[model samples]
Target: MDAQLGLRERKKARTRRAISEAAIALFLERGYDAVPVAEIAEAAEVSKRTLFAYFPTKDDLVLHRFADHEDEAARVVRARFAGETPLEALHRHQRAALERRDPITGLCDVPAVVAFHRLVAETPTLRSALLHYHARSVDALTSALLETTDGVAHQELTARLGASQVLTVLQELANTNQRRINEGRSADELASLALAEADHAFDLLRNGLAPYA
Candidate 1:
């Protein structure tokens, strides 16, 4: 039963990838707004119903890769080690992603990733979808923090504030990295600097921001 379930999941993942690749190629060949769902379904060799089964809306076809990470921050916080604080766990996670050159961490030189970033930045629709993903990340992180928190008055509010800061800092890092990539900077060239800058940002978050004002 487990093997069957796993096989089903692998098939679904392959189909999802096929649909996403088709959509991206068409979007890049033309413009995002110019591509139709029917064209994408045809390109992926799937019926419109099948494509919609994997991705509900038109935006989902292009942005579903981000859905995989929508709750990643919260998972990191929930799974922190005995002595690890949420920020510390998150910091380690970010650094590891950079070391692996994960495109989501802005530490990848993959042409597809660079092009995807450009599409998201330049296209109003995708930019809006990106915000939706970030909002989900913040919500998940806030919930995870609340679960482990105790005796703090207004714990919910505090969790939200912390979640906001952490996500915003990461977003800023990705933005900087993408801008650098646009300038022909390689991912390896940005890793050390990103790590240093990220460390400083996390320090400010950990130590509190009262010193900034």
Candidate 2:
């Protein structure tokens, strides 16, 4: 029975991947608005009903790649090394991702990755979907932050504030990295600058905004 269930899950996952790959390929080739859902289903060799079953909405077919990263910040905090503050863990994770040229960090210069980012950025509907994803990420991170009290009053509010700030900073950094790479900067060239900027940003987070004030 367990083996059957595992096989069923693997099949479902393959179906989902096929649909997403087909959708993205079509979108890239013909533009998001130009590609019809029916056409995508046909390309994936799945019926429209099956496609809809896996991805409820058209935007989801593109944004599904982000599902794994939606709760990434929260997961980092939850599994942080003993004695490592949530902020420390997050900063370390970002630096590591940059070092590895992880696409999430926007430091990857692969043509396909650049094209994928461009597609999402240029598509109005996909941009809207991304905003929704960011909100969910903030909420998840806020819950994780709440568990790591920092001796502050109004802990819930503080956690919410911290979560928003942390995520916003990271997003901005990724945007900068993406922009630079888009403008012909290699990931290797940006590595040091990216690491330095991450360190500066996290230091500010740890030390507060005293100097600016």
Candidate 3:
């Protein structure tokens, strides 16, 4: 039974990948709104019903790539060491992602990732969907920080503010990396710069930022 279930899962994953890849190719070639779901399904050699079963909305075809990172910040907070503050944990998490060249960290210069980002930037629908993902990440991070035993005064307000600030810092870091990549900077040429940016941003979070002009 377990083997059968494993096989089924693998088959489902394969189909989903095929559908998403086809959808992206079509979208990249002919703009997001210009490409119909029917064409995506046809390109994937799957029935429309099958495609919908895997991805409920058309946006899912492109945006699903981000689903894995949705709760990542929250998960990092929850998994922090006992002595670690939420801010510290978040900083460490961002550093690790940058070091590993994670795509969500937006440090990747791979052609496919570049194309995917270009599609999102050029497509209003996908850009809006990206905002939705970021909002959800903020909410999840807030919840995670609240779950920790930190003695933060006004926990709800603190959680929301902290989460918002951390996410904003991350978004800026990603934009800087992506901008450099688009300007023909290789990932190797930018790693140390990315690390320095992370250090600068996280230091502000670590040490209070109240005195800034």
Per-residue alpha-carbon lDDT of candidate 3 for residues 1-213, written as tens digits (9 for 90 to 100): 999999999999999999999999999898999999999999999999999999999999999999898898999998999999888888888888988898887799999998898888788888888898999999999999788747869988888888899988998899889988999999889999999999999888877685583
Best TM-score goes to which candidate?
2
TM-score of each prediction:
0.94, 0.96, 0.95
lDDT against true structure, model 2: 0.94
Give per-residue lDDT, candidate 1, residue 110: 92
Compared with the true structure, what per-residue lDDT tens digits does model 2 show for residues 7-85?
A: 9999999999999999999999999999999999999999999999999999999998888899999999999999999
Q: Which stretches of candidate 1 lie over 4 Å from their true place?
A: 1-6
Give Cα distance to truth, residue 62, candidate 2, Å: 0.8
Instruction: Give the per-residue lDDT of model 1 (tens digit) for 52-94.
Output: 9989999898788888898999999989999998899999999
What local lDDT score does residue 35 receive in model 1, on the 0 to 100 scale? 95
Instruction: Judge candidate 3 at residue 195 and give its lDDT.
Output: 92
True lDDT of residue 120, candidate 3: 86
State how far residue 22 of model 2 sits from its true place (Å): 0.5
TM-score computed on alpha carbons, candidate 3: 0.95
Alpha-carbon lDDT, every model: 0.90, 0.94, 0.90
Q: Show pairs that collide, candidate 1.
A: none
Error of 3 at 66 (Å): 0.7
Better of 1 and 3 by TM-score: 3
